[model samples]
Target: MNRSALTARGTPRRRMSVEQRREQIMDAARDLAVTEGFHAATLERIAQACGITKTLIYQQFGNLSGLLLAMVEREFARAAAGFTAARQRPPQPGQSGFAAGVAGVLEAVDAAPATWRMILLPSQGGPPELYERLDEARRLTREALVADLLAADPALASLTNPDHEAAIALLHAMSEELVRLRLSDPAAFTVERLLAQAEWLAKAMFGRRG
Candidate 1:
């Protein structure tokens, strides 16, 4: 075997590439941000969390702001994908789509409350680029929801002017409202209660049949 190949196999293989390594760094940053607030996430801290060097982080992301932007973007995408997936879990024969979707969202939110909080409420010290990336992510999330809606209700297409933008706004609002609830009462954010509330709200919002 070549020296490189041997080295690749000699030590435990790193599960991620350079780009993915950066992602791991950001994931750690996100965890810190959620738990300790954005201001508390530092290069040394992130490097230590990833068991890598600050130099590696600097190589991938220019500085702290760069890291924050990456973390923000990644967190948004993770939440969006997770919630979408949870909403789509296969039902047991006759489960309501609305209920399933609501449960999925709640599950996703539970999966990463800290990350969701950061996205829903970008606080002081967050980078400008983070805001831009989040804006894009928000738009993408909205687009995904619009597609889901159009697919579920083809008859609605005849309306000619479905307020997709409004729907997105409402969804964002609902997400933030939930975030506020969590902030108001950490105990109330328990997975089961939050999911039940989300299920009820989603059913009412979508007019889903029982």
Candidate 2:
């Protein structure tokens, strides 16, 4: 038996690599923040959840805010990739890339509700800084979506005037509300039904041009 393998209590210590350790800590923090409140997932709680010391967590992430910011960055990157993939997918007959993009985001939420909720849902008692960061990310996403919409259907190019910002805001708001409804009541807001309604609305707004 390797003498160094066992602890003083004769229990084997799980020595994770640096990356693995960071993942474990981040996962613990995310799970706690999502399940409980963000404030509840303090550094101590995260450390405890991951069976690590608070000092180790600090060493890994510098602070609780640092850990949270990292989580936000990762989630945003994932969402951006999902949006890009949906837009790049070969368009289905009678389906615009914009519609596909919307569906892709919803599908991602279905796949990872907790992760999406962290950004989508209102953070009641979470740090104001967190909310600010999320708001900025959302703003950037909306701008990107507007660009994609114009690219997907060149007709929309004419709509980009002084009041275009308001239109984009309204469109983004509507999509977000639909997502919230789907997440809140899946039975009432089935993906098929939502997609159909969205398609209908899209046709009504833009007409069957292509």
Give per-model TM-scores. Answer: 0.63, 0.80
Off by over 4 Å in 1: 1-24, 44-53, 90-96, 154-172, 179-186, 202-210
Q: Assess each prediction's global lDDT (C-alpha) against the native.
A: 0.68, 0.74
Question: What lDDT tens digits, residue by residue, belong to model 2 across residues 116-136?
Answer: 777777456766766887788
Candidate 1 lDDT over 81-111, as tens digits, reads 8877965775435444444555566667666
Cα deviation of 22 in candidate 2 (Å)?
1.0
For model 2, where is the 10-residue window of minimal lDDT? 156-165
Candidate 1 at residue 46, lDDT? 88
Q: Alpha carbon lDDT of residue 32, candidate 2?
A: 80
How good is model 2 by TM-score?
Answer: 0.80
Name model 2 segments beyond 4 Å from true. 1-14, 157-165, 208-210
